[model samples]
Target: MDKNNNAVELRNVEMHFNMNKEKLYSLKEYFIKFMKRELRFERFIALQDISFDIKKGDVFGILGLNGSGKSTTLKLISGILSPTKGQIKTYGTIAPLIELGAGFDMDLTARENIYLNGSVLGYSKRYMDERFDDIVEFSEMQDFLDTPMKNYSSGMVARVGFAIATMTTPDILIVDEILSVGDFHFQQKCEERINKMIDGGTTVIIVSHSIDQIERLCKNCVWLENGKIKMIGDAKEVCDAYKKS
Candidate 1:
């Protein structure tokens, strides 16, 4: 596709993490080891030279098993974490549902977080105020709106997060694995909303382990393995190949 038609573009992206190669029993042991020049570190590459294009208004899918860097890719696009190397370009506003409580403050009440999170997403006060009721209604947390976010269950936090992210159509909507944490009813409602956004011409990127869901919603898919892209093409074709692997 042409560059003008792309909603997201990633080029040679790589993410790296430094980890202690060996574990010490305690700080004292670690100090002793360090003093003896015995400490070792490993440079782990979570994503290796990833590159892809998400077409405008398309439902793009990322498929991989655990530790394949699916969530890391989303974070780079969302601007939550910068890429250690390479470049990422996004055309418009992005709403990201990457993980549970990712952008929320634990001590803040649900009511306050609605605004807080909205602000983080670049929504103005007036904008969030207009959609406040809709957010609470969709999440079904009206009763606990005053409760601190730390007290909310994982499912409840996921509900609120999804509601705020999808309250209105964003140019780029990125969803990770948070939908699977919701109950069946919540999941159904969320899918319905996603379908609505699709009709409204929103560009969506989804990372899911569910092949069926990917086949149903995505037009193009990328499969990653061992921090590298194993395949990229039609959703069904990649999913079929993934099942065999």
Candidate 2:
């Protein structure tokens, strides 16, 4: 891929939200409080002055601690939340694995949910049919195909979700801490699958808490602290610095 070919770009992007300072019992109570000038809110800035460019086929990592806006940044890139200011531009189709069960119906069997979830992902019936077996094999849920997902374990659900979400080689794959899915052995399987996607030239943006995982899988990275960029550079250097902090 061309070095100048950008897969994702953000310029001075910022996110803001007004958090309620008090909770009311109902809409009627909220209206009475608002009328009486009792409503209070605090401005929360989730991201500020964020700017970065992810080149085509680049594996980028975002590292941060709890409440550091790491997941918020991924949500912005995945279009789950719009930026409050600045610009964001992305090239090619995006596959976001931010929430594994977003499209799942808990009452539905894994078999039914596979096709339903595929449709939610914008795949046609024929497309899903062709890849159905591959999905089952990847998830290793052959025995539970007919079982309701409501009865499945968290790891089991995550595996199926991950398998379906990554079935195709997307142009841009936005993964948010999904590597923690399943057991240690299954985590390795997930990493191997992601590695395969990287080999296929997918532009992956990963947000992970594991410093070693970030260094191993990413070429470049950014560290965010208090919703601001603390460092941005080679993955190893960034990870090393973040680990020290």
Clashes of each: 0, 0
Prediction RMSDs, each to the true structure: 3.0, 1.8
Error of 2 at 39 (Å): 2.2
Off by over 4 Å in 2: 1-4
lDDT of 1: 0.91
Candidate 2 lDDT (Cα, whole model)? 0.92
The local distance difference test score of each candidate is: 0.91, 0.92
lDDT of 2 at 124: 99
List, residue by residue over 83-123, the lDDT tens digit for candidate 1.
Answer: 89999999988888777557899899999999999998789
Candidate 1 at residue 108, lDDT? 96
Error of 2 at 109 (Å): 0.3
lDDT of 2 by residue, 16-134 (tens): 98888866669998999899998988899999999999988999999998999998898888888999999998998899998786899999999999999999989999999999999
Pick out the ten consecutive residues of candidate 1 with the lowest summed lDDT. 94-103
